[model samples]
Every structure is written in structure tokens, then in C-alpha cells.
Target: MNLTIQFYTMLSMIGMGAWVGAALDTYHRFLQRPRRKRWIVFLHDIFFWTVQALIVFYVLLRVNEAELRFYVFIALLCGFAAYQSLLKKLYTACLEAIIQFCVRTYQFFAMLIRNLLIKPIIYLAQALLALFLFLLHMLKIIFLGIYKVLFKLLWMLWKLLFIPLGFLGHLLWKLVPQRAKIFIARYAGFLKQITKVKGIILKWWNAIRTRLGGPRE
Candidate 1:
């Protein structure tokens, strides 16, 4: 818990520092006069960078070797300060203000993206959900269509043929004993005949189709 709190505090500090740094950069670049106070802006930049660097250094020290890290931190701070001032010369006097404005603009967009992109990760997970639902609905419709056609075919068969077969089966079942060895024998023979007839018909159909240049069964 202590570590969690420390980490949160550190994160908050970094966020606040970034906000301040960006604002300062914007102010110095655009709103403030460039010729008026070069020394002041330089000093302000140094101070803010130093505070930020110190915070960073402190955070690192808590997790790193102290002596070597402190030296590195100092060197980094010096480099950071130098870079901040050097930007004025590097980007050219005319473009310095524009560059500063661009930095602030980038920061704004970055913050915007961070907030906007992560919020709906779970809720908006399926941008494809609607497509999935549509596909499911289409599949259901297709299945139902096929089912209705099949049911109609079966209904016709029952009316024309299966009803009679059912009646015949019922009569046989009633006349035959509930436990009949002969019933099993007859049933097996009937199945074998049906299979043999089907195979013969299929072979004949294939032969006919082949002669007619149609697909084989």
C-alpha cells in the first residue's frame, strides 16, 4: 500500500510537472516577448527543469544505486538545461515560437488521445459486434428458411407415404409380441435390402450421368 501510494504520488507529480512545463514553454514562446527577458526565461527554464530532474532523480534513487546515479542525474540535468536553451538557437529565431506552439499542440493531442483511447476499451470492445450480430441474424434466417423447406418436404412425405408406413408399423407392433426374436431378424434383413437398393440405384445414376456428360453421383 505504501509503495502504491508512493507510485501514485510520483505519477501525479510528473503529470503536474508536464502541464507546467508545457504551459511555461507556450507562454515564453508566444505570449511573452522574446527580446524582453531572455535571462528570465532561461532562469525559469533552468529552475523548472531542475525541480523536475530532482523529482526524477529522487524516484530513481529509491530504486537504484545512489552514488553513481546522483552523478548521472547531475549530468542529465545539465544536458537538459543546455538543450532547452539551445532550442532557441537551433530552431532559428523565426521558427522558435512556432516550434514552441507545436510542442504545446502535441502535448494537447497526446493528453487527448490518452484519455479518449483507453476509456471504452471494454465497452466498445467490439466495433465489429454489430457486424457479428448481423451475420448471426443472417445465419438464423438462412437456417430457418432451410428448416421450413425441409419440414414441408417431410410433411408431404408423411401425408403421401409415411402415414401408411406408420399405420403398418403400428399394426405389426400390436400383433407381434413386445419381446420378439423374429422382429429383430426381419428388421435387419429389411435394412440390408434398403442399403443394397440405394447403392444399386446410386451406381446406375452415376453411369447415366457419365454417359450424358453430367457430374457423376
Candidate 2:
């Protein structure tokens, strides 16, 4: 009975070791090297070793009353060696195929969502923008037309007022006293000085523009 129990324990330990090997391979392939996070990698290592230790301890406890024996270690090593030699390639290939399938499935769904949902929203926004621009352009044209009409009316009013005012001023000038005529002459001289200064500034501005290769205004 004792021999039978030991034999079964060895078998169980071997199976457990194969499972551990497969788990480590999966981690290396999918999680360990691919992820660059230190804390996460530490956690994965800790969890993997902790679970393996617990499993080992439990199996030992059941089979050999938790006795630490050289044969138990040997059995585990043999199992791991067998897995590496016979099963590693097949398991890795299957794992890679599964990963590829999952990636393809995700991409298909993403493309579907972009076509069905995102594309329509983008098109609707563009149409609304075009409509807004058209309305703005129409409003600008209407306002410009109204401004031109108002400006023409105001210019006509200014011209009508200026002609009457000019005639009144001439009549007043003829009726003024001699002393008042002298004051008006002084004011007229000041106006001529201002016009002379304005002409000089315009001449200098045109020279600067020509030197800078700017078109004459």
C-alpha cells in the first residue's frame, strides 16, 4: 500500500510540474517580456511562485506527510524536462494561433464601429459646417448691400448741406466789418500752413513707399 501511494504521488507531482511549465511559458510568451512595468512583473513572479509553492506543499503533504525528500524534487525535475523536450513547441504554436485569432477579431469589430458609427457623425458635422458658412456669407452680402444704400444717402445729405452753408458763409464774409475781415485773413493763412504741411508729409510718405517697392496709393 505504501509503494502504491508513493507511485501515485510521483505521477501527481509530474503532472503538476507539467502544468507549472506550461504556465511559465504562457507568462513568458504573453505577459512577462511584453510588459515593461516593474511592479506588475514583480507581482506576476510572486503570484506564480506562490501558487507553485502551495501546490507543491499540498501534494507533498498528501503523499508523504509533508516530508522533504530528494525523490520528490527528482520527480518534479523529470516532469519539467519531459515537457521541455516533448511538448514545448506544440504548446507555443497553439498559444500563438489563439493570440492571433483574438487580435483579428478585435480589429474587425473596431473597423465595423468606425464605418457604422464614426463615419456618419463626421459627415453630418461637415454638412452642418457648410450650411453655417453659407448662411454667414448670405448675411454678409445683405448687410453690405444695406450699408452701400445708407452710405449713398448720407453722402447726398452732406453735399446738399455743404452747398447751402458755403453760400451763407460767402454772404456773411461780404457783410463783415474791416477788423473782422483781418481776423478771417489770419485764420485763412493758418489753414494754408496746415495744407502745406499735409502736402510735405504726403510727399515723404510716397518717397518711402517707392524706396520700399510698395505700390503708390
Candidate 3:
């Protein structure tokens, strides 16, 4: 190659070497190999080296038409050595600062979204639920009040009819013959005895069912 082409290739190789060093540092910083499983670290290392090789080859192709020479390798090594000695610390610090800033920004946005959107939606749902429950409570009270008022009115009407019927019954009793009155009394007594017997039988049945571990109803 001409001297001009050689110089350009040398410069490109040096720059590429420095870039590779920086990329390696960045990869290690993010990868945190010590925290990863051995197999996982192995896989990541393989991938990183493969990608770096491909990038280096691509840059070499761009600068020197894919030429391979001893001086190119020497220039690359010098550049990498220089970066390790002079730039590693500064680059690592800047990388860490940038990563921290990104993390903080994400956290801030998440907090803002939660406060502005999610919290209001949650509060609105709670308020709607409370309003629904309150309306249901009010409806129950209103219905109960109506039921009580209707029941009281019916009770009063029944009382008014009952009083007149009781007076009519007494007059009818006075007009009834003595034999018919005796018959009615005997029938009522028989009915009362039948009811007592029925109640006694039901009690016995319930007791038997309870002993058998069955429901009485």
C-alpha cells in the first residue's frame, strides 16, 4: 500500500484498538461476571469476543481494504496499552454516572405516573364503591320504612275489623241455643288436644333426627 494509505490504516487501527478497550470495560461493568453463573459468564464472554472481532475486522476492512500486516497489530496494541494506562478510570466513572442518571430518571417517571394516573384511578374506584354502598344502605332503609308503615296500617285495619267482629260474635252467642254452644265447645277442646298431640309427635321426631345427625326442617 502507498504511505498515505499505510498512515490512514495505522491511525484507524489505533483508534479501533482504543474503542475495543473502552467497549471491553463497558461490557465488564454492565455484565458483572462475578455475580453471574459460570456457564452464563462463559456464554457472554464468547458472544462479546465474537462481536468485538467482527467489529475490528469491519473497521480494518474500511480503512485498509481488509489488509493484514504486522505493523497494524503493533499499532493496535500500542493504542490499547495507552487507553488502559490513561483513559480507563475516566471512562468507567463517566459510564457509572450515566447509568445512575438513567436509573434515577426511570424511577422519577415511574413515581410521577403512579401519583398522577394510578393513584387517582384507585381513589376514584374506592369513592364509586363507597357511593354505591351508601345508596344501597339508603334504599334498604327506605324500603324497610315503607314495609313498617304498610304493616302498621294493616294492623290498625285488622284491629278495627276485629273489634266489630268480636261484638257481633258475642251477640250471636247470646242468640245461639245451649245445645249448639256445647257442641262448639266440645269440638274446640278436641281440636286443641289434636294440636297438642301433633306438637308432641313433631318434638319427638326432631329429637330422633338430631340423634341421627340429620336436619329437623
Candidate 4:
């Protein structure tokens, strides 16, 4: 409307145009269009253009009440042209350098954490596990050795007593009445028969349960 407003609007549009160019470069740099699906690229393009348009319109609203005169377009084009000719190469180079720095920083921190924290913890855990296994193995061997020694001593003691005890029992049995021996032998046979009958019944029950697909105790 007035000279001051018009001048301000032109300057704002020029700055907006340069900003848009820079934003476009950044977007495309990250978008990786060749790797993106068609639908995704399409959506991203629509959103990007919409946002840029809205930004330009909002700037215009602030500068000159959203007025659209012919000079605004000329000024925007000039600013974009100036960025392309003068600033594109410098900005791109700086951006690449910054990206490399960031990647190096991330890699350094990751390596530091792995070496300082993770590796030591893993080694300590492995050491504890190894020590535990070693102690368990030693305990097993010690118990087994003690068991073997006890078994041998008990076997020797039993052998040392058995012959004399057996001879004494034979002499005592000879002194016993024949009728009493006969009664004990018959009762022992009866008990053996009962045990055999129990075993057979249990076998039959287990077989029946198996055939019926029932769980066994």
C-alpha cells in the first residue's frame, strides 16, 4: 500500500525465497528420493510444497497484510537465483562437513561405551560363571571320593564280621528245633508269593492305564 510497506514486503519475500531454497536443499538431501517408494515421495513432495506456500503466505500477512503485487514475485525469484549462484556450493560443503563430524562423534561414543562398560561386564560375568563351575566340579569330585572310600571301608568291615557271624548262626540253627525252622520257611515262602502277586497286579494296572491313555503315577 505505502512505500515503506512495499519495501518491507519485498525484503521479506527475498529472505523467504532464500530460506525456501535452503530448506529445499536440506529436504532433498535427507529424503533419499531414489530409495523412497513412489507413494512416499509423492506425499512428501505435497507436504513440503504446502508448508513452503503457507510460510510464504504467513510472511506476506505479517509484512503487508497478505498483499500480492507483481514486485513480490520478482523479488522472490531474484533471491532464489542469488542463492543458487552464490550460496549453494558453500552451504552444501558445510553441511557435509557437519554430517561427517556428527557421524564420527557418534561412533566414538559408542566405541567408548562398549569398551568401558559392556566388555568388562561380560568378562566379569564369564569369570564368575567359570569359578562357579570349577567349585561345583571340585565338590562333586570330593563327594564321590569320600563315598568310594566309605563304601570300601564298610565292605571290608562287613567281610570281617560276616564269616564268624555266619558260622555262629549255623551252630545256633542246629541247636534250634526242626519244627520252628519249618514254620519260618513256610511263612517266608508265603510272603514271597504275596510280593509276586502284588507285582503282577501293579503291572496289569499300569498296562490298563497305558491302553486307556491315562497318566501314570
Candidate 5:
């Protein structure tokens, strides 16, 4: 029974060493080697060795009641040598392939989600923007049409008023005294100046409206 326990203990240590070797190889391939910072690499090395030492110590305690033996150390070295010589290449290749497959799968799903969800949302936003612009253009055309009709009516009313005013001015010019005539002339000049100012104000107003994306005259 004592000999059997010793053999089993050796086998367990050997298996543990093989597993540790594989874990170290995987860590080096994926995490340790790609690091650019010396401090980060050092921290990782320290953490890896610490965790491995704790696991070996636990195994030794469980198997041999925490007794230190030369043969136990030898068994661990032999197992690590076996893994390096026989299994290292195959295990590393399989681990790399598995990692690549997972990365490809994640990228594929991400692209699929972008196409199904994000692309459609962008297209919908563009369509809404186009529709809004079209509606704004139609509103501008309607407002311009109303402005044109109102301007035409006002112009016609001004012409109708001018006809009677012209006749009255002619009669007053013939009948009025010189002083009265001079007063009427001054009043007519003032009216002309007022009309000029009105024209200037209308021009400025139209320019402002046009700049604001409203209809132009």
C-alpha cells in the first residue's frame, strides 16, 4: 500500500506538470509575448509563477502530507520534459486555431448586426431628412404664391387711387393761387420721398427673407 501510494503520487505530480506546461505555453502564445511594456511582462511572469507554485504546493500537500522528497521533484521535471518534447507543437497549434475561430465568429456576428440594425437606421434617417426638405420647399412655394397675389392686388389698388389723385392735382394746379400752388408742390415732393423710402424698406425686407431661405421676389 505504501508503494502504491508513492506511485500514484508520482503519476499525479507528472500529470500536474504536463498541465502546467500547457498552460504556460498558452499564456506565452496569447498574452505574454504580445505585451510591449516591460513592467507589464514582469507582472504577468510573477503572477503566472505564483499561481503555478501555489498549485504545485497544494498538490504536494494533498499527495504526500507536505513531505519534501527528491523523487517528487524528479517526477515533475520528467513530466514537463515529456510535454515539451511530445505535445507542445500539437497543443499550441490547436489552441491557436480555436482562438482564431472564436475571433472570426465574433467579427461575423458584429458585421451581421451592423447590417441588420445600424444600416437600416441610417437609411431611415436619410429618408426622413429628404421628406422634410421636400415639405419645406412646398411650403415656400405656397407662401411665395400668396405674396405675389397680394402684391398684385395692392398694385392694382394703388393704380386706381392714382387715377383720381392725378385728376385732382391737375384741377388744383389750374385753380390754386401761387402760394397755395407752392405749398401743394412741397407736399407732393414729401410724398415722393416717402414712396422712395418705402421702396428701399421693401427691398431690404425681401433680401432678408431670401437669405432666410424664404421665397425671393
Candidate 6:
């Protein structure tokens, strides 16, 4: 279990790295002025080049085979180049997957909240109104218990419906046409928008918590 947790943590870290990598690509591509390119190049040389040198040094210290180390270094450099060239595309695909996951999860949670909170509120209001009407001699409380049972039954039915609907949403995405895939390829922008929204929410929540004692005991 500990190993499994560590593995998952590593994956999460890699996902974060990929996210940062994508953001970096986006920033450099669109935001960098032509005159600032020299500064950016200098920064990249000072940072990533140093990292590359360290990787080489580490490989040389650990490897017994010189040819193997050379090959590894070549592969590493090639991978870095590929990563730079394809970072936008890779990030876009990752974001698309994330968006799909978020949408489905949101739908599931919305259904749950509607059933648990909203439905109960509506039912309570209706029950109160019915009770008032009955007291006025226009109705009876004979079916109050039956209405209670129906509320419970309706919630259960909705839970079942949304669960299957969420699954179907996932399934439908898998059946998209190849032509539409080209249009969907701009998913990194979608991810960026979502991340911006998340950042705003985080900031708002943090400020509220800092001001108030937050959740009551």
C-alpha cells in the first residue's frame, strides 16, 4: 500500500510537471516579444543546459558501459527535443482528458447535491404548504407518509439515472469522428481556462478561510 501510494504520488508529480511544461510552452510562444527572445535563450541555456550536464555526469558515474551511456545521452537529448516540439499537442490532449473527467464528475456531484439538498428543500416546502391547505379543510394528511416514501423513491431513481448518464457521456466521447478530432485538438486552451477558474476559486476560498474561522466545529 505504501509503494502504491508513492507510485501514485510520482504520477501526480509528473502530471504537474507536464502541466507546467505546457504552460511554459504557451507562455514562451505567445507572450514573448521578439527582443526578449535573447533573454529567454540565455535563461534556458543557464538552466536546462546545467540540468542536462548534471544528468550526463550522473550517468557517467553510474554506468559501466561507455557506449550505453552515450546512447542514453543521445536518447535523452532526442526526447528533450521531441518534448519541446510537441509539448503543446501533448498538453492539449492531457487537458482534453482532464476536462472530460471534470465534466462527468461535476455531473455526478450535481445530481447527488440536487437529490440530497435541493429535493429535500422542495419537498419540505410542499409538505408545509399541503399541511396548511389540509388545516383549511381543502385536503387531508392521509397520504403524507406516502409522499415521504415517494420523495425517497424519486431520489433513488435520479441517482440511478445520473450514474448511467455519466457513464454514457464518457462512452459518447470515445465514439467521436476523426474529423472532429482535429477541432478538439485545441483542448489546451480549454484546460487553461479551467485552471484559471480553479485558481480564482482557490484564491477566494483561501481569503474567506483567512478572514473567517471557516467551517464551524
TM-score (all chains, Cα) for each model: 0.26, 0.61, 0.79, 0.77, 0.75, 0.29
Q: Which stretches of candidate 2 lie over 4 Å from their true place?
A: 1-8, 31-51, 58-65, 126-134, 171-217
What is the lDDT ranking, best to worst? 3, 4, 5, 2, 1, 6
Error of 4 at 209 (Å): 35
In the order shown, the candidates' Cα RMSDs to the true structure are 21.0, 6.9, 7.4, 8.6, 4.7, 41.3
**How high a TM-score does candidate 6 get?**
0.29
How do the residues 21-121 of candidate 3 rate in per-residue lDDT, one tens digit apiece?
A: 99999999889987999999999999999998999899889888889999989988988988899998999899999999999999999999999999999
C-alpha-based local distance difference test score of model 4: 0.88
**Model 2 global lDDT (CA atoms, 0 to 1):** 0.83
lDDT of each: 0.62, 0.83, 0.89, 0.88, 0.85, 0.62
TM-score of 3: 0.79
Per-residue CA lDDT of model 4 for 135-170, tens digit only, reads 999999999779766755764686689789989999
Which prediction has the highest TM-score against the true structure?
3
- Span of 10 residues, lowest total lDDT, candidate 4: 208-217
When sorted by TM-score, best at the front, the candidate numbers are 3, 4, 5, 2, 6, 1
- On a 0 to 100 scale, what is the lDDT of residue 108 in model 6? 96
lDDT of 2 by residue, 1-217 (tens): 3888788778877877787788889878877556568888888889979998898899878877877767778888888888899998998999999999999999999999999999999999999999999999999999977976675576568669979998999998899999988887879978899989989987886676576454554
User: Runs in model 5 with CA error above 4 Å?
Assistant: 1-5, 32-35, 177-217
Q: Highest lDDT: give the candidate number.
A: 3
lDDT of 1 by residue, 1-217 (tens): 2566544444444444443444456556654656657788778778767876676557545544233423443444444454455543554454676777989999999888877886566457676687789999999999977976675566467568957897998898778875684667669978899989989988986675465444564
Residue 163, candidate 5: alpha-carbon lDDT: 87
- What's the lDDT for candidate 6? 0.62
